[model samples]
Target: MSIVGTEAYPQDICSGGGEMKNLWASQRNNKGAASPLLHSRGGCKGKTQDCSLALSPPLGSVSLKCLPLLEARIVAWIGGPPASGKSTLALRAAQYGFLSADCEPPSSGPDWLSGFGAVGMTNRVLALANASSWLLGATTSGMVVGSCYGEWMPSSPAHIMRVLLLPEQGVYQQRHQQRGSTGWSTDGWRHAYRQYRNSLLVWQRDNGTSIIRIQDRPNETSCPDKTLFDACEGIMAHLDKTPHELCFYCRRTRPPQSAFWLRCPPECLGREGGERGGAGHASHEGASFPGASSPRADSDHSSKVATPAEMEEIKQLLLATQGGRLDRSATHNWRNPSVPGRYGYHSIQIGNVNLVGQRNPNERLNILRSFLNFTGKVVVDLGCNVGGMLHHLAEVKHAYGFEFDPRCVKAATRIAEIFHLPEHFYQANLNTFDPNSTFRGLEHAPDIVFVFNIGSWVGQWQQLYQAIANTGVPMIVLETNNDKEGAPQLRTFRDMGRKVQFISQAKDDVTGNFRRKTYLVTPA
Candidate 1:
């Protein structure tokens, strides 16, 4: 059987090595257009020449015994709104043995044939031919790859996969805000998001394209790594290809050179100069703050045992500042590390005076740590009295506290300044708390919000919850009052129609009377 004029040919005919090779050589010598079969084998090199290979054999002249050798080439175009993790997913696909390139122009490189531009279509098409699989980070609307560059695609539409990540609007907006770039305004971002959705719909209906949509659950925080891995798996399944087994150390398909090694030759144990390999990079090895074991601590001084004179001075300062009274219902039993038996107004180590609060902040922190990671994350503590919890959470990138009492706020501020902690405190009534106003000067949105045991005390808890919800924070740790008073609070929270995931219930280790329940609140 003979195939002509860019028509699809059977696998056996297309895979005839001698015939295909002779045809490709003849076309190259004559400067004629290259065949898709030749292109699949990277025959074009870097040329922009046209494709014009001809199969002129008589019907039945070609034998049917040719072994099929050419694997279908695939070019996956990944599209989504800005900050939807398109670039991240493309790079991840590269780690999984796929050739990857971004559609955006290179920021610092030779600008030739930049980023799927019209002039670069030939180059990109040649790239598509060279790799078994290519993952391209597409433009917002994906029209560049789907329409403008359609002519440059492989002959089989089945080989061009379009994947669109459609995370919830709130999640998208939150990611955009975290990027801290001024490239797009709110209106502009919304417009681009809509354009992507509309374009995908049109491609599905008009082109009969099978579009893959990766969507995030409502109010759930999207994990880019997990999303990217799932997408790569989906693409592999769609292509009827098995994913390569990756090395445990490098996360690559290359096999280890030695039976005792977990990493490939390029990623051998000693190659990284004692550093950890691949994405599991080792964290910096020093303490980040004073008296804190966390690597993110930011203080210069270590926990030094305060001399008797310094302790007396600290005691006098606490007494003179707030008349030595615990502002909130719970006592701020700050403790000295040297004397574990003693407790004080706050839990902070200041030149040896370890002010340990009555409520074991570490105990509460352990519960929160199990649910959320504080390392390099922004935290907002609602009704943080004397900064007990926030003080202990020094590992966070930045900690902000809000308390209704001015005295409590002042004390919290004093503690932070003395300890050289990266924390800020403000006095704000919970009834009218506004996240935007509270976090006005912040560069990033809060990652975790704490509303511990303050629902019953705040008269307008609903308003506060609504305000926090509007911020689109991924996690909210809410601890209700004791069972009796907390029942109404819990019911009210549920009535607000938010998704409340029960975390755990434990007795108030500090108060010892109430068994409080902790829950995670997310948008529905």
Candidate 2:
């Protein structure tokens, strides 16, 4: 039997050598139109035009012998975990034949396609959205997108093809810590991984999609070999093929090259004038997925500098500080005089709110201008940390800051008083604040609420929906690191009957460096 997409004749069996050579030749023959999946592999070992050799394609129906790994829009829903190989597997499929679409949710906007270097909570939604969108109204022979499953956006059930990739908890953590990543220190990845796994189980029970274990494959390689054609072959296995019957193609091991660094020790940098590779690539050595990591300690003194080891320490410190409560009163210094340069330098007012310390004068001015255009007087701030945004809102709108952190509430109150803004700053989680308590005044309710990426808390969705349902105010939500967790959080919000109008979600840039993201989500 011959496959529709293949350029060659079908053989009794598909060998790695023939398939790889064919895919390699295909690279140079159709350079521009070549799949992004093939891009990484095509560049490998300088095989510019290796995939063109139409020697032979894999044979045997997916049902006849191989596992029926139907290429039906499989969304991996990859989360931040160790050794999950979400990108590795997804890229392989995309390159081979699986139409892969990478979605960075938190960074959703016109420029959402960029900023997908690391696997985080936000990437899950982005991946889901990209896969789902591709699956929407289109026929997918085989599609695999990897991100966290919880971040999935509800689309037509017919379009979804679910596949779960799980690794051993210990191995996951070991691999994560090895690469200086912060979120998945094995234990954390395991926790989140279990959550994702459980969610997948529930999802599978309701939504039927193929699930295959990497360990079960005939070849030892669970993921596709990262060569141009090898990646494409992995995709072919998923495409319109039966999951259980798809033959596990043998994957040859490539040299352990650094696409980005996981966790290389400082010693890895000290090797003299470069014995094997260039140290210039060291900066990007352990960058999360796609983001580059700067290796030079003095490369950018503007941002807080931490050595690779120091960064690991800092991450450990941050994680250690997670559940600990810091007494605000313990420190006599109420204000951090060293205000970050990232906060645009500008002074703007919205109603009684005056946002001081805006580092960027123009961005602040533009925001104030937009505030005047929409808001008459009332303004609501979601995730109003330290009431900084509220101070700005008070300049034009009757501003109120809603913060869940007690420390932030204290700081916001102080900042509001310091700025002498008439805005009301309250300590409350927007997801769960009581309507009666929050709505004490006869004062005009806010027409626009400002929220910054506070929608990702799965445990708090119900409360958030209730709050929105009760408030009935059109909100402008700004999310930090929106590129990381944008789509998953927003999808949850949308599912709750809250009409969300996307404003913009992109990196919260500071000068030339990337900071976080600002999402302007308004209730439609």
Candidate 3:
């Protein structure tokens, strides 16, 4: 319990050291009285019911254990079946400083409050984890980590780590057989496992989590030790860093390639440098495509008869593009996400964000301004979300975008056609993007490639490098987090006998740092 009507706060109950103390003192002084949590030099006869410290994000009564656990930065949810060895691993992990609170109730508490049932146990654990996240959300630093089993999620967007632990099927089956449910038949246990396994696979792809696939070990035995260590290492690697630099992406650590970091023409450097639909491409002004319409933009297409068939086709295409889901799936959240509010690459419209220009807009404006003079050059953007950057550049060059989402493809195509720019947006996973087939039926190979935010994910750098190597594209522009994780991709480009040049730096909205460094790699 927190001490009230006291001048000094206990070091054990609250953290942040001198800084936190000083912050509390300043607030108390401004209020012209000792806060309930802070003791006044002259003790006053006040009731004990006053809240603690009167902080903006109020701190309710907290246990000593939960307060200390706030120091941990990452919360992991480790899921597996019974006797899969995760319980021991979870205990070991908690003993090693990861926090765990058994949701069992006291003897005096009501039976309903005991968390006796399976759903009740899960709910209690979820509540505890979320309460800890609430504390983390209150302060810039400090977190309370947690681990749970079999498909649990904390609603708070604090540092979250999800691990789906899967031992060998034989091992799992053996364990289940040894301890079968009291009323369960042979098929009953098997069916339960299959259901949980399906959900695990679904969430593993859609839910954003660092994965631990514990299969046959060195001795052909399954072990949770190695898997736990790997998960901890990966989780800690991102501790204390800004949400911007994640496992898939990091802010650039050094200056980009020197050759590509040229200053923009005097006009493009200042405040009025770039504007939407500017003077350079005024020949196609007041252009209109009678048949071009978007379902999102023009909601009332029912007035036209043939448009319904077209809309139906678009709907089917979208459904197929979304892997037959009417709504956003969980795996999509994991694929290209590094931040909380901005969960995925296509969240630009939903998240009320300028995914590109949030950080120093001038940095990207500078990059786009440099390509203004090339009218006939081919510019390709891999992983273009909504084609915002390409829309501006399309005014000067022939722009084509390869995106993963059909929804994004449709949105980009509508915007491109509206501007009367010759830009094509196609949906394709950049990791497995085919070069020859992608460039098929075209007259000339792409002169330049735009590799933006997709470099840090699985197979991204390698596949992009392979495509560049195979195509011999002269110049490529991309951004990288300043952290060391991004160095390997640049190194790979250099290793391919390509000369990498530093371009410009942009501010990251998430981290509020100038770590979004851009680079240009050219063939030697």
Candidate 4:
């Protein structure tokens, strides 16, 4: 049976275009272009509403009666690029009391003739169609994870909500390139998928799909495995708990309307000339729940600053660097979740991916410029995340960063290589490592040291300072979470006969007040 949704639980449907008529109804003439989106909907044309869904599987495909009512509970349909750890995330998510499955569309061989055009196509289209049916039926109960390919959307839109994983373009390319090592050709489906990838993202915006920016699985490292499985579990738990609502046709989450016998209310269904997109569709009659107000946890922000094309490019660049895994999302803010991505970065412009608030590179660079010229300086940055400050100091002859997270270091290195900058990033336990030892044989000796907003570690500052002091580097730059914390760090440098010059830094993310100050500690 075709998956269908009533306006009462519109948000339950797969993420896509504006509120529409029932899926099985006559298509609307909204002048919108037809997308190759596997999941889709249509405008209602007063079509007859059927209570029992018909799982019309392809030949030799899984049947509708096969949904494991006993085993399967609730499934979330996931959509994103390959190797995005959809299965891994789904499995981890299942730990939160859900049965999950990651589904892959069947692959097919090349149709030699189709490669002549700009957009190459696959000959194995029908197999994918059958797989799509299997995925749809699979979603009838337990959690399901799948990708966004042609003619596929969540088959159980009323129960299966869609989640789109958006990775930085660098991360996307890197992951695929990595798969190349195993001798499996990366050129086939991925190439075509990448071409239309942004379109799917665009469809996400147009229809209000949920977007999650994840980091990539990194290569084997010489250092100890420090990845915090606990933190990730928390993020996943938080995500699963937070509610999201698509503003296009939001309905309160409760008993799904699809379970209701009628599409429209019993009173409205028989009304003259009824349509799903009309006033009767957004009905608020007896739909409210006690203590529950809105479908969205909070109203997420939407930025209008960047043009669509620029936004698309930024999105591609972002996923290319950190797709399929978890990165420090905008502001380290994972408090509230939303349907359309709740981005923390400045929406109007491109900057480094920030874990906290808008730690503007220009602001940091300007603070540096006040104390010393970065031109020809050999810079060593401690606690750098993707090297935002190093990127801002473009005039520096050379830059080296020591970061705790291996993923962050790789991201920083990727940024440097992409921009053709002279920078080196090494994964280091910054808190315990001697700063001089951290850069022992690096391309350039440290002429200046930067310690940006890492006040959370109280005890390590003294050790970090002692290491830097031995390096003959007389200048140290620092930013703090607050002036109260910055005072002590600045005092320690003063006790060492270093003059502290200060500039304003990022605002307190929680309060949106009290901007942190940047300090330049120079040997006096």
Q: Which candidate tops TM-score?
A: 1
Clashes of 1: 18
Of 3 and 4, the candidate ranking higher by lDDT: 3
Model 4 deviation from the true structure expressed as Cα RMSD, one decimal place: 23.7
User: Candidate 4 lDDT, tens digit per residue, 386-483?
Assistant: 56666545345566666665555555555444433445666555555665544555545667888876654434777677668767786888877676
Candidate 4 similarity to native, TM-score: 0.35
Ranking by lDDT: 1, 3, 4, 2
lDDT of 4 at 52: 10
Instruction: Summarize candidate 2's per-residue lDDT along 205-243 as a digit string, tens digits.
Output: 333232232322223222133222222333344433532
For all candidates, the clash counts are 18, 97, 16, 30
TM-score of each: 0.38, 0.31, 0.35, 0.35
- Candidate number that wins on lDDT, 1 or 3: 1
For residues 18-113, what per-residue lDDT tens digits would candidate 1 score against the true structure?
464466556665534544553432212243322222232222212111100001123566665656666555543333334455554344445333
Model 3 regions more than 4 Å off? 1-363, 368-373, 508-513
User: Cα deviation of 496 in candidate 1 (Å)?
Assistant: 4.0
lDDT, residue 141, model 1: 14
In model 4, what lDDT does residue 296 have? 13
